[model samples]
Target: GAGVSQTPSNKVTEKGKYVELRCDPISGHTALYWYRQSLGQGPEFLIYFQGTGAADDSGLPNDRFFAVRPEGSVSTLKIQRTERGDSAVYLCASSPEAGGPLFEQYFGPGTRLTVT
Candidate 1:
């Protein structure tokens, strides 16, 4: 079976533009997560979804960022009014079940977004 995948491996946009990053998780994985990784920094948690609803979105930096998993499989991360500070590699991960200390997550290659 295919693993988690992210589209548009790289993206470049002007500041104040809007961009969407997509992710497809493994079939039947009930938990999905989004993260942002900046230069030399660890991935920062953005949001977590269980099934078709968001379980935790506290990691989202601000209102400009949002994500949805309408059917409990594929998800999209939407960024509005992009800024230079938003440039980073956006990563997606999925686990067999909900995230916990014992569950392992599979990760995608990530979509690199650059706002110039």
Candidate 2:
């Protein structure tokens, strides 16, 4: 892909349901990240992956949130037992490399998940 792409730009799910959002980062990029943004808040880091391994998952709110980057390319974010408080935008970004002093992340438009 030429740029980051996130699926189901808008999602409406009942509370306690599970949802999966997809992200496709720029081709050849090695670093992938997932973030969450509540209304009027800056994006909050969720997870970061360098290749197939998650370098950081400290920012995930709870065990209900999980993400994976299998090929160091496309990634998926899975949320289980979604709650009304979980309604927000899920964002994805990618950089050419990870663990560098200067790394610029390119972001996807984001998936707006609404828990009704």
Tell me how candidate 2 scores on lDDT. 0.93
Residue 57 lDDT (model 2): 99
Summing lDDT over every window of 10 consecutive residues in candidate 2, give the lowest-scoring window: 94-103
lDDT of 1 by residue, 8-96 (tens): 89999999999999999999999999999999999999999999999999999999999999999999999999999999999999998
Best by TM-score: 1
The TM-scores of all predictions, comma-separated, are 0.97, 0.96
Taken over the whole model, the C-alpha lDDT of each candidate is 0.96, 0.93
Instruction: At residue 55, give the lDDT of candidate 1.
Output: 93
lDDT of 1: 0.96
Q: 1-116, model 2: which lDDT tens digit per residue? A: 47899998999999999999999989888999999999999999999999999999999999999998888788999999999999999999999886585979999999999999
Q: Which has the greatest lDDT?
A: 1
